[model samples]
Target: MVSRRGTKSKTPGSKRTSANPPSRKQFNPSLHRFQERYEQKEFQAKPHGIPVRVLSFMGVTVLAMSMYSGYLYASYQREVSKAQSLDVPRDVSDRYNSTAPTFDAEVELSEKAMRLGKKRGDLIRLARGDVLEVSCGTGRNLEYYDLGERRGTDDQGHAAVIGCRSLTFVDLSPQMVDITREKFQAANPEFTHVAFRAQDAGAVTVEAPARVRDLAGAGKDASDHRAYYDTIVQTMGLCSMADPVGTLRHLGEITEPERGRILLLEHGRSHYDWLNRILDNLAPLHADKHGCWWNRDIGAIVEESGLEVVEVKRWHFGTTWRYVLRPKILCGEKK
Candidate 1:
C-alpha cells in the first residue's frame, strides 16, 4: 500500500515488480522430456558400445583359432590319404632311379643310417654259398663277401691281404644295377664273382643250372618248381617295396627246403607307444619325401607273412631289427 502511493498506478491485473525479478515457474513438458531422453541414451550407449566392442574382439579371436585348426587338420588328412594310397612300383622305381648313382654315399653318410654301425659286417659274415642280396644298390655288401685272402703290398709297403668273394646283386632299377656293377668292379678288379640283375624281386623266378649250384657248393634243390639259394639277404630294402608281406612270402617260396634262411636288417616302428605315435603322425610325410615307410612293424610283417621267425633282435628303441627267418612250411609239412 505504501509503495503504491509513491509509484504510478498499474493497469488492471498488472503488478509492480522489484529491481531483481523472481524466476517464473513456467511449464515446458516437451523440453524436459527431450533432456531426460538424451541423458538416458548417453548412459545406455556408453555401456552398450563397450560390450559390443569386446564381443566383436572375442568373436574374431575365436574365428581365427578355428580357421587355423581347420587348416592343420586338412594338412594332416592330405598326408594320411597320400600314405594310404601309396603305389609301390611307381614310387619305389622313381625313388631308386632318382637316387641310384649316389644311394650308397647317402646311406653311409646319413646319421640315422650310420646307427647300424657294425651290423653290416655281421650280415656279411652270414653270407654262404649261393648267397643273394636283393635291392643291392651300389653293392655296399660286395666288399664283405667271404672270399679267401690274397697276400698283397699295401700303400705303405706293408704286407696286406685282401679277401673277396663272388655274389649276385639284384635291384629293380637298371641305373642302380649299373652303378652297383661299376662300384664293385672298381673296388675289385680281380674279383669277378659279382652278377648284377635289374629285375623285380617279387616277379623274378629263381633258376640256375644244377652244375652252377654244385659249383657254388650249395645243397640239392627241394622242389622242381622252386630253385634253392643258400642264403637270402635284405637290408633296409623291405620298407620301399609295395608289399613287404608279399615279398617275404615269395622269399619263402624260393628258399631251400632243408637249410635256407633269410637275414634282414631293417628300420621300423618304435616299440615305445609315444615314439610310435610320433612316427605314425609323420610316417606319411617321411614316406612321401624319402620313399620308405619308417614306421612299419617289422615283427608284425614277419608274422603276417607266415615266415617262421627263428630269431629277432631289436636295437635303437626297436626301430632297427635283425631277423633270422626260416622258410615257410606248408600246413601239411609241419612236423
Candidate 2:
C-alpha cells in the first residue's frame, strides 16, 4: 500500500523508454522517400508507353513485308532485263537456221490453226489439183487432196483427172518427211505417186536450163521455168521462214503467170490500236520466251515483196490475217 501511493501505477499504456529504440518520425520519413524514388525509377524505365510484346510484333511484321517487296522487285527486274536482251538484232538467215528444227513444234501449233474458224475453211476451199504442200508435217492436210486423181484411178477403177495427179510433200526436217511419208502410205497404200522431200523452201529451183526445159516440157530456159508452181499454199509457214518477205518474193517468182495463186494464212500485227500497243510493249518478252519475233509486221512485209494483195481479211478481231496475193509481175508475163 505504501509503494502504490508513492510510485506511478503500472499499466499497459504506460510509456517505456529504451536506450536503442528506433525513432518513429524519422523512420516514416525515410520509408516515404524510398517509395517516391521507386515510383520515379519505374516511370523513367517505361519511356515508350507501349508493351514490349506489341512493339516486337510490329517490328517483325514490318521487316517481313520489306523483305517480300524486295524479292518481288528483284524478280521483276530480272525478267525486264531478259526481255531487253532479246532486242539485240539477229540476221534473218541466222534466225531461220536456228529455228528450222523447231518445225516439229510449229506443226502442233498449225493443228491449232485449223480451229481458228471460217478463214481455214475458206483456205481449204481454195486448195486443189497437183498439190505441192510445203511444210507438210505428218501429211495432216494430204487427205484434202483428191487421192483418186493422184492415183489415176477412182475407187470404182475409173481414171479421173478431178483427183490430184501428184502430191509432193516437202519439209525441212527428214524426220517430219519420214513421218509424213508413212502417214500417206498408210492412208493410200495403192497410191504410189506421192513423193516426200526434205528440202528448204528457199532452195527450191531447177539447177539448169536443160532441167527446167525437161520439167516444163517446153523449150524454155531455166529462167522461163521460174513460173512453175500452179498454186502456193502457205499455212502458218511464213512466220517460221528466215526471211518471210524474201520467201514470198521467191514464191512469187516461181508461181505460174496469172494462173497461180499465192494463198496465205498468217498471224500478224493487231489491227486494234490498243491491242497493238500492248503487243508492242510485250514483244520483247514474248519473242524471248517463244523464239518468235512479234515485231515483224507480216502484212506490210508481204505487200513490200511485189505481191498484190487481192484480199486481206482479219480473222478473230485481228489475231490473224488471211491474204490472197498475186505477183505484181508474173514470170514469163509482161508487167
Candidate 3:
C-alpha cells in the first residue's frame, strides 16, 4: 500500500501502477472476407472480359467471311458448270470461217453494248424463271440472270423450271456459243447448269427440230409445258435476221401462253432528225463496214407482231439508236 500524501509516493520497493494498454478494435471477419472476394473477382473479371469480347468479335467476323466465301464459291461453281455443259455445233467452225467479223472490232462493240445495257438495268430486272436468251453470244448476260436466288420449292424441293429455273443461252454461231461457254466456265464453274444451244433465232423450227420432236413425243403434259421457256430475250439479233418480224411472231407463238415475257435490246432507226439524216447519209458505207442496217424500225416490227409493249426505252450511242422493249399480252392473256 502507498502513503496518501501528495508527494509521498509508493514505498521504494513497491511496484509502480502500470497504465492500461489501449484495447485493440476487433476486426470484422465478414467485411474482410467480402473485400478479399471483391478484389479476387475484379482481378478475374478483368482477364475474362477482354477475351470474351475479342472472341465474340472474332466469331462474328469469321462467320461473315465464311458466308461471303460460300456465296463466291457458289457463284464460281455455277459459272464453271455452265461452261462445261455448253455445246457448240460443228457448223460454227464453218460460219466463223466464212463471215466472221473482225475479232477486235466485235469485242470493242460488244463491250460498249454491255456497258450501256448494264446502265439500263432492264436486263437484270426482266430475266426470270425459264429464260430464253436469243443470240446469247458468249453468255455475257449470265451475270444478270439470278439463278441461285429463286424462292419456294417443289414437292421434291427439286426446283421447277417455270418458277425456279434461270437463263438458257441460244446462238446461231457455234463459235460464239463455244467462246461464251468457255468464258462463263472460267468465271463461274457452278453455273454449268445453264444450257447453251446452237440454233438460228429466226428459224427455230429448222434449228432444233430434233429437240422439238422430242418434246412433242413427250405428249401434252403440263410438265412438258413447264420444261419449255417462260421468257424470250433478244439482244442485237433482229437486225441481222432475214425476217425480224416473222421471227418475233414465231417466238410469240412458241412462248408459254400466259407467262411469256419478251425482253428486246435492239439497235434500230433513230427518232432524232439530225441523227437520222446522218444515218441515211452513211447507210451505204455503214452497211459495207459493219453488216448492220440502220434503217429498220425494230420497235414498229415488235408492236405489229401481236406482242403488247410493256415498256420502251430508247438509247443513242453516237449514230446508233437502241431500244429496250418489254412485251406481253394484257392481263397475262395468251396471244
Q: TM-score of the candidate numbered 3?
A: 0.55
In model 2, pairs of residues that clash are: 149-163, 150-164
lDDT (Cα, tens digit) per residue for candidate 1, span 1-335:
33546975657789767999788999899999999999999897675545777899999999999999999989978876776675433244457788776666776767345556577777666666566778776676666676543666544787644343346678888998898788778877776555678988776556442112332333323332344666788888888888888988887776665567788998998889988987887776676666777888888899998888888888888898999888866755622
Better candidate by TM-score, 1 or 3: 1
Q: Tell me how far candidate 1 lies from the true structure as C-alpha RMSD in angstroms.
A: 18.0
lDDT of 3 by residue, 42-150 (tens): 8976755457788999999999999999998787566545544544321222333234434435656865764754742545555556667787765556556656535
Model 2 Cα lDDT, one tens digit per residue, 1-335? 23656975667787888889785754678889999999999998776778889999999999999999999878867766676676544333233334445645764676576465355556755544545666554455655554544335534777633455456677666776787788788879997655678777766652211112233344545354342555566666665566777778877776654555678877767768877765665567755444455556777888688888888787655767788877786467542
* Per-candidate TM-score against the hidden true structure: 0.62, 0.57, 0.55
Q: In angstroms, how far off is 190's CA in candidate 1?
A: 2.7
Model 1 ranges with Cα > 4 A deviation: 1-91, 111-114, 148-166, 208-226, 330-335
Best-matching candidate per lDDT: 1
| Clash tally, candidates in order | 1, 2, 16
Ranking by lDDT: 1, 2, 3
